[model samples]
Target: MPDKDAGTPRVFLIRHGETEWTKSGQYTGRSDIPLTENGEKQVISSARLVVGPGKIINPSKITQLFISPRKRALRTYELLFDEAARHKFEGKVEITEDIREWDYGLYEGILPSEAKAGRKERGLDKGRPWNIWIDGCEEGESPKDIAGRLDRVIAKIREIQGPYMHGEKPVDVVIVAHGQILRAFARRWLGFEIGVKLPMMLEPGAVGVLSYEHHNVDEPAFLLGVNMAESEE
Candidate 1:
């Protein structure tokens, strides 16, 4: 429904279901965190929402499935078909690291409280901003670095779109991935400023359908929908 006739692929970007770290608000990056029980339930419901009632995705229309090689994302993709309630997505699937989760350095497994406490304990919170993206404290990644990586991913997506976004066919692309990285990909692909204070909201087990329309000046990428999780219903 989101402009597949214009050679623009209707990309369905879904973040994997929740993990223990996700529930605890920890910075889950690169670490392999399995889906929680509720998270698996979310996948089943979310898949039904996407493939059935929502009617957002057409299986035949889907040309390819791109995924991050991470465990969580891989499991999410597997659940899409194996889950009893979500049999509609039995389509071809492929994995792509270009869509992998962002690699957070020293801050990878640290819980939010520990981070804040450590900051105060060191007496550095006064001068530096507390937020990770804005501050980029210590060995962690700065927004600038993330924005740059996102740009590379965006460039790859654009390349796949072909002929500078002038391809003439309807295509659907499904990307199974993690939260923060997928959000960054969507933001960068839409030409949003990198590392802005306001970030796109892409919850676990959430699906974001993006419509890319080629215009004379630039290809306008609009969000057909964002953060469509089972929790919403």
Candidate 2:
């Protein structure tokens, strides 16, 4: 039987598994890096234990799947769902640039320390500090730009949720993407402004849930560190 968590709708935010750059603390924006062997194994385990017939994400409950255009996110998505469950999924899986990692621009392929040092050398920091949310990247997106892009996506997700929240049908959505973007999405999901430091940290291969507090769409909230033990119906 197809499982359904009727009433409140949810948007599951998944961070892709580890990559070479991720392990080395390098900025990996728009880079097409594949996951490491351990990363693959971790996600495979996550799929088996966290997403299945009677798991945190019931295959029958998914209404839509959003993925970043990057290879890591795509691989994570593939690993998060088994072949049979993927075949059984009736939702639309869309690869959107909107959910891609924040373009690191001049900071790409470099560590934060290197970028900050470079900025200091160039007198860009003005003797203070460099915050991506405030100062942004040299050639990449500002916080406001990211907010604008994600807000549009959020609006579309809300459109999908309207019917589900109103008792029309069950709708659960999933997003597989990078760490920074997923955190930003969660903050924006609750209508909060993006800050220099995000309120939460999303570890590699971690999953977070965003939904209404008590079945009211107006009161969106984040279910921090959602584990399979607490989510199973």
Best by lDDT: 2
Candidate 2's C-alpha runs over 4 A off are: 1-6, 166-168, 225-233
Whole-model Cα lDDT per candidate? 0.69, 0.82
Residue pairs in collision within model 2: none
lDDT of 1 by residue, 1-233 (tens): 65343444667888999999999888887788899999888887877776632356555455567888888888887776445433444554556666777667766888777877887877877966587656664676666777886676556555555543443443566788988887777777677754565557888887887766552214647655443421110
How well does candidate 2 score on lDDT at residue 25?
98
Q: Let me know the TM-score candidate 1 reaches against the reference structure.
A: 0.77
User: In terms of TM-score, which candidate is strongest?
Assistant: 2
Q: What are the per-model numbers of colliding residue pairs?
A: 0, 0
| Model 1 poorest 10 in a row by lDDT | 224-233
Q: How many backbone clashes does candidate 2 have?
A: 0
